[model samples]
Target: MDTNGMDRRQFIKVSAAATAAATAGVEGILAARQAPAFAQGTALGMLRWNDFVPASDELLKKTIIPEAEKALGAKITLETVNANDIQPRVTAAVQSKSGPDMIMTLNNWPQLYEESVVDVSDVAEELAKKQGGIYEQSRAVAQSGKKWLAVPWAIVGLTIAYRKSLFEEVGYSKFPETWEQYRDAGKKLKAKGFPIGQTLGHTFGDAPAFSYPYLWSWGGKEVEKDGKKVVLSSKETLESVKFMVAFWKEAHDEGGLAWDDSNNNRAFLSGTICATLNGASIYIESLRKPDQYKTAKGAQMRTDIAHAALPKGPAGQFAFHVPFSHMVMGYSKNQKAAKELLRYLGSKEVFDKWFVSQKGFAVGPTRDWEKHALWKEDAVMLPFKDAARLGRAPGYAGPAGKKAAEVLTKYIITDMYAKAVQGMSAEDAVKWAHGEIQKIYG
Candidate 1:
């Protein structure tokens, strides 16, 4: 499918057009229209992750929902849980055929539950056409063939947030640009009691965000481009695993094996770690309470924080920025109300408030948001503005479809490294993961 080349080219074209539109001062919210009316007492339920950006959740509860209800004439119920717990909830709901009418999903989950979810091509296509087209990474995960499986939501851009002063003290004036250099810097930092923090646990976010990109950068992938053959047991895969085992021992926080998405955020904020691959949440949280999260010198920690893309490997620099979407469950009787809610949420008039609340933690699904004025507010956030441009989905070198989603939900890639770090041989770990993937792809 040449997904990489196609997405890159399309993104460049869309981005340039969007930027030019912004330059011409064409930025504005979608024009107001008549609110869609529904039956009295029609209530729709939604499930989503407890946003890493608490302000967004607060805004949702305190403002957006009330406004949405007034506009849509449908009572809404919102439920949130840990990101790691969402998949289980989704599985249970789909099996029982009665649960939240709509669920917020991460990565390529739309592909994973394609048959169980209602097609929202009408909602998705309208939003994309109005919002300068959805980013390819977002589209790749939400769209399957000619149908849009879900409405593409915002993308959480992942970057390595580090303590700038700590790296400088270790004689690294700038963040390391290559994996080897990063490992060297991490080794020195760890000796100084500041290790790089990363998780290889069964997390839905940070674990695979690190694992998939790290694997791809070293030229390891789960399947071939045709998406039929398993190819994880390669020399490249083994070499990456071996390096990770040593890296974990010499440079990373050893306790990270038990950590989830929020652990590294807390570890970095607590000043126990120097760097970690995370969303802008860590930085945003520090900014929210400058006095609460201060350095030893009593300086605001946000001042000392900077973000960089993951280090480059032999293959190149890559990222797996988490793509989010809204899926309307097919089993729900409230499909009409759920689709209305999707349209309301996807509208810029509403989403802008949530986006601003994120403060660059989550960028829009479309290219136009890259032109948003928020990027100019903080230099540290600039890197994330274009992060999705380098994004590669799971099942890379193949379609990020059902099989890839299976591998992701099973944590195969993340566990491959976890196994190697926890005493398994690199070759054995790769072989084990390869066999697991073979079962799914076959």
Candidate 2:
């Protein structure tokens, strides 16, 4: 919390410059000069998710790849794909015992494919030491058993993005901080014809991200901390489902039942829903759109829509964050070159540049980077300042593993809530999901 040795004023200035750079389309701004070309002997192939943030991919192509090439004297062939597609590709690579030298993807894929991913303990430990140690969520995500299967990259923070003026119209000056308040607000807003939404469909982002946080907030967990037992059929879980049922009935439209990942973003931008839980992308994307949404008159859409922390439940407010990780494939012919490239990219100096380029859409795993300037100075980014520490990875109260990832990816939790809200008994829904989860854990 102490700025981690960053001078506050200096960081504020840096934040301003970063913002200016984003709007001005600054090219290679982080660089002071060019360097000698890479000696063409070693080649490393990498596969990673095509960044949702366009600037991130741009920086990778324009600056990061070039710099790493110059420093390591290696030719790095980078191929990026959609986040959803990374898993199948990684699985194919693992099955065939050959693929790109390194891969980066979302949420415990390293753990899912741990046997096929090289041990990156050296990279993990060394980077943690360099970056003031890894955050708890990072460690839980990237490590499997006793080995570090991957290096934790950045975490995408998930929180509630809502319309402030609408809340004010409902007599609340700020976003609700507790579930009781949220329900009340939802009812009032729905009465005013403004729906409150949490996706019940099979969305890559909205379904699990929001549901898991709500589950944890109500003290419901898929598995116990030991990670081998099913504990989802408890009172806590039923309570979470029942709460969701009530809220959905009072607030959301039937369309939310089938909504996918981009639906909420489109809904919010079009003023269809007044609130939803999502990453900073919802707000970041609004910055590029026209100021035509009438949610807040005379104010820009970016200014009217605000980010808020997850509302507290009976347990407390717990944020849900997905850990994106980087790993070297076990079958790669160029393991050494792969590790070297990760080391270069993971350094504070280089990562800081990339973080700035990302426009603060994500938080790195390091505790020290918590003091990064964008968090303190950017109004839209400030809500996520504590995400690295306060957040819990998916499958909380248990280690992230294949079972956990399976439960999450299959939309079990989302379906549980949806069934209950759509008039199925909460107990029956829990029983159905509990059985599905047990099959995975067994």
Candidate 3:
């Protein structure tokens, strides 16, 4: 908790400019000098969710685009489109080869643009070499067969949010540290008519946050590297799944099984449930936006609620982050310009605005930003920060990974996994889900 390492934003300015300059000096400026000939203005057709971090044009000009253009020597213009409907536009644009110069979003976009998208592998490697390894969990996401697609969009930020005053009302000066203690606290909350809002609906929100940490704490894993073979089905994973299902009925609302990711956020915001699960940033932003939080019974909060990392599971405490990064197109007319842009974006100086998002600072999945000036010495970050240390991203990165999640959600969402969780017999639920994947995937 020290204002130690470079305030990530400051580091970005100095690092990005310096790195861009070095590229010009070391690689020569042919691309820099040539980009303007083909591209006349800074016009980029971009698509993304509504509230993306670094989504502002001000940040784009100061933090991202300036450094990138300085190095690439071409002007870029950005066009924004709503994510809910942008897929079709992006598809048409890219297929027609008239898409924006750059596009940003989750790495798991349906149809990847290896040709249109810039490959930022070099940028990612540069960051890793400069920083003491850019967190393996995230690095894994950037790399594709030795080619890198992304650099982290700042730091991984999946963290828990909780009601602070609620903890105090429960007669505890502090919250419990271990899983057992957490369950006991839940019992206490139930005694007070504030039981946790449980779920089985959506994987991106409560389902994933609630499950992956369970696996990490128990030392469970979704896959194992067996020499050249990637093994998906494993005992550790089975145990983790079974354990997660056990909480489906206990922790969720009566309609929890039919809920989706947004359900938890709505549940918590509405105060229908004392605590649910969600991302650290979303939780913070929710507190700031009254519109984002509504009552379970449809009332809105007159005051802000609080959030922290969910309590540790039986295995151990852990966090779940969406490890995101940027990648470049292999077939770009401006490969050199694209790569330079990639380097500039990854440079700490260029991406600093991401840390100052209305939500909270995003550091390495585990690095503590609580002590930083940006956080202003806020202690509420402690638990969330602690959760980051051992957290895991749900396997949503690769094609196989996405398919796997779909498979799980399809079967598990309907209380299928609940049977196993409730001790209705693990072999059936476990084997059904696992065997189904093996057949389809194999």
Candidate 4:
């Protein structure tokens, strides 16, 4: 899913240090002695996804933006669209050279647009030094070599949100810990009319979040460590695809093939599906409207929901979290204002408001957030606390760069599984995906 405080004396000391650091040449510093001067009607355009947790978006629009505008002395317009549609908007902006001055990007997209973005090394490094360092997973997608193509934002950790009662009713007292066990449990659940929910569509978030980790857990990868050699057509990949074909037939909601990232969330909330691999948004939504979402037995669905990490496979458990970052577009005329806005929004005080609104659907890019007291508020959210530590970026065993971004944007891995589930032979699906990836890598 796309999911803080300080003492007064300590805050003052930190603010003073930040002011000093701002004078030391950092381009974007929120704690500057005074907001930088700009044209009387300076304005910046920001494009972001319609966040899964609606409250987070609401927080941005109602609270954060006004505060930012007053603090930075610029008019800010926030535009949001579905996550799947973000890439096309980014592509359009890069091509037209005039669009939102700041664009929020997911996964390795910053890498795909590396040459079209301004280096925010000072902004990123400053954030890292102040907060605990950015997690390596977040850093991988935002940093190219030593340059910061984008400033790290947040990581939306995807987990298997399941019904505790449903798993127990299927004779599994605990959530299944391995793929075979999960499949076995899912088979029984489907027989009882509560199948698992998942998507294999060309979604930007949940589709890759599931597909990449599933591939890696079975020892399949799109490329080798050198990041050039295509090696996806392996015995392991074919085996995983073949297994998925049967698993889907036996255990999943068949309607998932056309579902987007939001579909599984809806399915789970409406009590139609027993479990889904998703961000904490599903559970968070239920919390937001406790009386609206209910279990089949007429109980609050929030009480029934619990989350587990993705089941382990032969190689090991893995995760492909959706890491988000803000890119200062190279074509932007409001570069100074946009960078200042990034600095403003990314500050701990401001980000905490948005983070609390998410209620654990999205975690901060830095390690400091894991230590936040909010994780202790809900046991169901604990699994996501350390999720970034276990995360593997796209193009596993290789750099998550432009080629990996191309493969991801193309939905190569996701289609590999979808094709098999739709009746293509597993070998053929694997071969098709391998060929597609080779076209990118070559």
Which of the numbered candidates is closest to the native, going by highest TM-score? 4
- Model 4: clashing residue pairs? 1-279, 3-361, 3-362
Error of 3 at 38 (Å): 6.9
Candidate 2 per-residue lDDT over residues 190-286, each given as its tens digit: 8988888777897767678788888988999999899888999999999999888888888776688888767888888878778988888888887
What is the lDDT for 410 in model 3?
50
- In order of listing, the candidates' clash counts read 0, 0, 33, 3
Flag the better candidate by lDDT, 2 or 4.
4
Candidate with top lDDT is 4
- Superposed model 3: Cα runs more than 4 Å off: 1-43, 52-98, 107-118, 168-173, 203-206, 227-246, 286-307, 358-361, 364-372, 383-388, 393-425
lDDT of each: 0.88, 0.79, 0.51, 0.89
Each candidate's TM vs. the true structure? 0.91, 0.88, 0.71, 0.92
Model 4: worst 10 consecutive residues (lDDT sum): 25-34
How close to the true structure is residue 190 of candidate 2, measured as C-alpha lDDT? 88
Predictions: Cα RMSD each:
10.1, 9.9, 9.1, 6.7
For model 3, how does the per-residue alpha-carbon lDDT over 293-314 read when each residue is reduced to its tens digit? Answer: 7544444442434555656655
